[model samples]
Target: MRIVSGGIQHETNTFSHQPTTLADFERDSGCGPDFSGGQAVFDRYRNTGTIHGGYIDAADVLEFDLIPLICAKAQPSGVVESTAFDTILNLFLDRLSETPAVDGVLLDLHGAMVTAACDDGEAPFMEAVRERVGPDIPIIATLDLHANITQRMADACDVIIGFDTYPHVDMRARGREAGELLVRMIRGEVQPVQAYRQLPLLTMPPMQCTLREPMQSLMQNVFRMEDEPGVLTATVAMGFPFADISAAGVSCLVTTNNDAALAEKKVEELAGWLWDLRDELQPQLTPIDEMIEFAATHDGPIVYADGSDNPGGGAPCDGTVVLRALIEAKFQNAVVGILHDPETAALAHQAGVGATIEARVGGKTDDRHGTPIELPAYVRALCDGHFVHHGPMNQGVVGEFGPMALLLVGGVEVVVSSNRKQLLDREMLRVIGVTPEHRRLIVVKSAVHFRADFGECATHILDADTPGIHRPDYANYDYQNLRRPIYPLDNVTVDFGG
Candidate 1:
């Protein structure tokens, strides 16, 4: 069987000030700067643990022809520019039109994406694809765990599987599942029927983590449910609260083999189960200043996660609150990194490795994250800022931070870079000449993804309540377009029809 595969993956944070553009996709897609459409998609994801990587594995194992199209994935940022979205959609549609007859289509989509022209980005992309391919051809998609599920998105695809794990280690698993299901549909093995439910709830990233309580056990139940008779697949999208859209909330979907009643029953059960845990799903955040006291008395290898300024959630990685607090408390043998400060990094690079340069670092994006820290920084090391992920999530994927410099500021090692990237893998620090295991205290500009790599070895991990758009508390954001009567934001109760 022949299958066309590709996607435009982006998680848009409507609260973020930085607008995603075509140039951003070209530079950061992991497909390299001059991203060739066909072979480049296969090359970039063939050996990795990504959605596309999973699709490639399924294609290889199933002995099916997987035709590659354009897979454009930009870093998580604000709403995509209208022109850029159109260009990408047109490219994908053109490729689909040019390809020979295909039995099915596989998509790697970030369900939370928003474009300047539309609140629901994936719906338009899928609708466009459906229009091109016609309804008979099956389309299966894999979405991030944080997708803001919509009725339109559900209507466009035969099956939409979301990652079951937070820190999102299940991209490949879900991808493979989507591919396998699409093949089943094409072969007439299983006629998939789906049921979707959008809950009256909005959840922050910290509590949405599948590794933690409520979600941890909840996802386990989801896995158990998937094993039930006649069930094809199930997904629980915790939803991305950062995207200020009408459909920015938690949801559940279930697909069964020619069993619409079974699908509806399973979907409602999943939604009701999630809604019951609403109170427990609210984020529990510890202020950075409070964490400093605990770190002072504690032993080495404590990880402080500043979720507020996480670039993964579209917050500027340049937040100085955590760094400033560490400096004020005179914490030694601590490492604060991968901070986004192009000016500081560039100066450090120019000054060379032993030179001490006076510069201001971080907080450059906005006032909400905190002001810049001006200090004399001793340049410890410099690098080109390119490394592969050495972690469970997105393993083997190439990551770049542009020009980077390891600066010793106030006896603390600060790894600053010209570009913004969330601190997820330990290799991000190791590449810049800092060993993560030996550090006394490690400050990371990330939410939960870092836990996938650092959580195993660290003595303690605390989520710091700093100031930024990606902060754990959803109430901090001023919602202009979000649908009302959601949990935490409002006290509207839900009845699941038990």
Candidate 2:
């Protein structure tokens, strides 16, 4: 059987000012450059730890012909440009039209994508594909755990599987599952029936981590349900709350072998269970000042999560709240990573290693993430910003931060980079000659993904309540489009019995 597979994956943040352009997709970073179309998808993703890699691996084992198409992705940013979205979609569809015959399609998508013209971006993309493939063809998709699933997406695809883990280590596994299920459907082994339920609740990134409590137990329950008779697959998407769209909240999806009743029952059961654990999922962050004091008093190698300014969630990744706090409090043996400031990084490169130079770093994107702090810093090290991830998430994938520099300002060491990226690996720090394991305090500009790499050695971990776009405090955001009566945003009653 010939199966066509490819996707445009992006997690849009509606609150971000930076618009995602086609150039952004084309630019190469640590995640790799974007492919316009065809065999390049197979060439770039094969043997990697990505969804496309999983599809290729499954194709080899399952002995099915897999036709490659356009697969492009950009760093998580603002709403995708209409031109960029249309161009990529048309490219994929045109390739599909060229294929002689297709039995099924597997899409690797991040369900939170929002375009300039569409709030539910993945739905429209899937609909256009459906228009080309007709009703008989089975389309399966693998999504991030933070997908803001909509009814349009549910109706457009046969099966939608989301990652069971938050740091999203399960990408390949989920992709393999989608491929396996598609193979089953193609062979008439299973008739997939899907059920979807969107919750009125939104979860913060810090609490949505599957490695921690509440989420860990919740995912365990999802796996248990998936093993039940008649159930083909199940997903518990915590949802990307950073996207200020109507569907920006928690959702549950269940698929069974042509068992609609069973699917619906499972979805409702999981949704109700999640609703009952709402309070636990709602995160409480410590104030930056208090957190610093706590860290100073605590043991070495503490990791302070700078979530509000997470570039992964579309923040600028140049927030200075934590860095400023660390400097002002005279904290010793501290390090702050991935401050996305090209000007400062360039200045460091010009100054060369072991040179002392006066430079202003971070807070360059906007006023929301603290002002740029001016300091006479010593440029300790510089790098080309290429390193492979050694963490559980995205392991073996090379990351690039463009030109990077390590600067020492007082007792604090800062890692400045030209490209905006979340601090998800210890390799990001080590690439700049600063070992994270040796630091007394390490500040990562990430929401939760850093936990996969940094959590193990951390003496204590705390989420800083910094002011930025991705802050866990829902009230701080001026959300105009999101459906009202959502939890924390409004105190609404929930009837789980129904």
Candidate 3:
């Protein structure tokens, strides 16, 4: 059987000031740059541990011809520009038109994507593809765990699967599952029936982590349900709360073998279970000062997660709230980083390693994060910012932070970077000669993804409440378009029976 495979992935934060453009997709980082046609996609993702990599492996094992098309992915950012969205979509469609007849289609999509013209971007793309391929062909798509799944997206595709892990180390595994499922369907072995249900709850990133309690137990239940008779797959997307779209909330999906009733029942069951655990999914963040004080009382190597200013969720990453607080509290032997500040990084690079320079660093994006603080910093180290991920998530993939520098600002060592990326791995600091294990405290500008790497060595892990666009204070955002009566934002009751 032949299958057409391609993807367009982006997790848009409508509150972010940075607009996602075509250049952002072409830039190297995250899942790498944009690739057009099968050869390019195959070349870049063949040996990688990405969704496409998983698809390629499955194709090799299943012995099916995988026709790859455009595969474009960008780091989480603001609303995608309409032009950029249309350009990538047109490329995928144009390539699809030129390809030969295929048994089925597999898509790698971020279900939370929002563009200027479309709030549910994946729906339009799926609808267009469905129109071209007609309704008979099987279409299966994979989504991020934070996908804000909608009815339109559900109706447009045959099957939808989302990541079960928060750090998202299961991309390859999910891709293989989708590929294997598609192969089975094409061979007339199973007929797929899917059910989608959206919940009124919006969860914070810290609480949504699969490594933690409620999500961990929830994912275990999903796995158990997947093994049940007739059930093909089950997914629970916690939803990207950073996006201010109407469908920006949690969702549950279930796919069964020609059993629509079973799918509906399973989805409703999962949703109800999640709703019951809503209180557990709300994280209690420690204030920056309290976290610092708490860390001081504890042992060395505490990990402070600055979840509010995480660049992974599309925040600027230049927030100085935690850093400033740490400095003010005279917190010694602390290393905070993966701070996105191009000007400061450039200054450090110019001063050269070991050279002391007076500069204002971080909080440059806006006042929401915090005001930039001026300090006399010694440039401890510098690098080109290239390192392989030594963590569970994207283990084999290489990451780039553009030019980076290790700055000793007072008692803290800060790793500043020109490019914005969450500190998901220790290699991000190690590349700049900062060892995390030896430090008294290490602050990562990330929500939960950092846990995949830094959680083990940390004596204590605290989610610090700071100020930024991606802050967990959901009530602070002026959400103009989200559906009414959502949980946390508003008190609401869910009727699972309906």
Candidate 4:
């Protein structure tokens, strides 16, 4: 059987001021081993700085004729540039058309992309692909746990699987499930049916994690439903709240063959369950001052989610909201990563390790998020940050935190680097010679993904409304063209497909 697979991934934040440009994608995400490398590198591309990966190791395991098109995505941005989307789409199609008659299609998609000219970006792309492939062939897709699923997406694809974990440790596993489901459908072993729903409420805070309270229980029930006879898979897409598109809301999806109706019913039940507990899914947000006070009193390390500047969710990752707050409150024994400063990093490196230097770090690009934080810090260590992901998301993948240094700033040891890196794992800290466990408070510039690695060790975890590009509040977005009459945007109630 002939199979064609590729990916176009982006999660747009309509609220962001930056446009999703080709250059952004090229610099932040692109590098298929096909591009010319005169380029300044995404030094921390994977975990070890290697790019050209999209299939997530499932490709090698399945071992079919595979064509990997450019799958580049930056953190949430403003609307995607039309030129960028068209060029990538054309390349992907050109590649697809060259291949022989295909048996199946798989896509690595971020379900929250929006274009400057259009909203619901995934629908138009899928419709184009559907037009190309026709109805008989099956299309399977895997989404980020933060995917904002639309009805058009559900209608177009035969089976859509989403990441079960927020830190995206289950990314490859979901790909595996999609690939296996494709084989089953192609073999006529199982027919796929889907059920979906959008809740009235929108967004469960930036750090809403599947391993915690309501989301954890929700994921457990999703598994239980899958174990039932005739249920192929079940998913709980918490939805990307930053994308002001109409599809932004919590959703439940179920796919199966033998009992399609039963699958729909099961999904509806789960959707209702999620809706009932919508308000409860949120992490208890602690104000920075209160969080510090609490941390000072705690015996073990406390994990703080700097929800404002998460690079994984399309944030600048350089906002000094928490840093400023920490400095003001005179908080100590805290490790906050990272302030993306190429200049400051260079200065620190030149200053040599153990030298004291004053550097202006963080809050350079977008000051609306937070004030600039300057501190006299001692350069502790510098390294070409390298580590293999020991987690499920990109396990064994090498990454680099280029020209990185540990800066001891006002009793808070900070991880500063030239490149923007997601602090999803503990090693991100450990690579810079800082042990997060040894600190009283560990502030991570991440959304929900950090919970995967740090949740186990944290005595208490709190998400703060720190400032950045990706705000959790949906109404704060300045939407010009997103479909109206949707949740939070227009306050419309949606019924589960009953």
When superposed on Cα atoms, how far off is each prediction in RMSD?
Answer: 1.0, 1.5, 1.5, 3.8
Score each candidate by Cα lDDT: 0.89, 0.88, 0.88, 0.73
Q: Pick by TM-score: which candidate is best?
A: 1
TM-score of each: 0.98, 0.97, 0.97, 0.89
Off by over 4 Å in 2: 28-34
Positional deviation of 146 in candidate 1, in angstroms? 0.5
* lDDT for each residue of candidate 1 in 1-498, tens digit (9 for 90 to 100): 999988898999899989999998987776665445778888788878898888899899999999988888888989999988898888888889999888999988899999999999999999999999998999998899999989999999999999999898888888888888888899999999999999999888888888889999998999999999999999999999999899999999999999999999999999889989999998778877788888888987999888888899998889898888888888889999889999999999899999999989887888988998888989999999989998999998988889999999776899999888889999999989999899889999999999999998799989888788899887688998899888888889678848
Greater TM-score among 2 and 4 belongs to: 2
- The candidate that wins on lDDT is 1
Residues 207-303, model 4: lDDT tens digits: 3576667677778887888898888988777777777666676776888786767976888888777766755754445677788888889875888
* TM-score computed on alpha carbons, candidate 1: 0.98
Candidate 3 residue 93 Cα shift, in angstroms, is 0.8
Model 3 — which ten-residue stretch has the worst lDDT? 28-37
TM-score of 2: 0.97
| Model 3, global lDDT | 0.88
Q: How many clashes in each candidate?
A: 0, 2, 0, 8
Question: Which scores greater on TM-score, model 1 or model 4?
Answer: 1
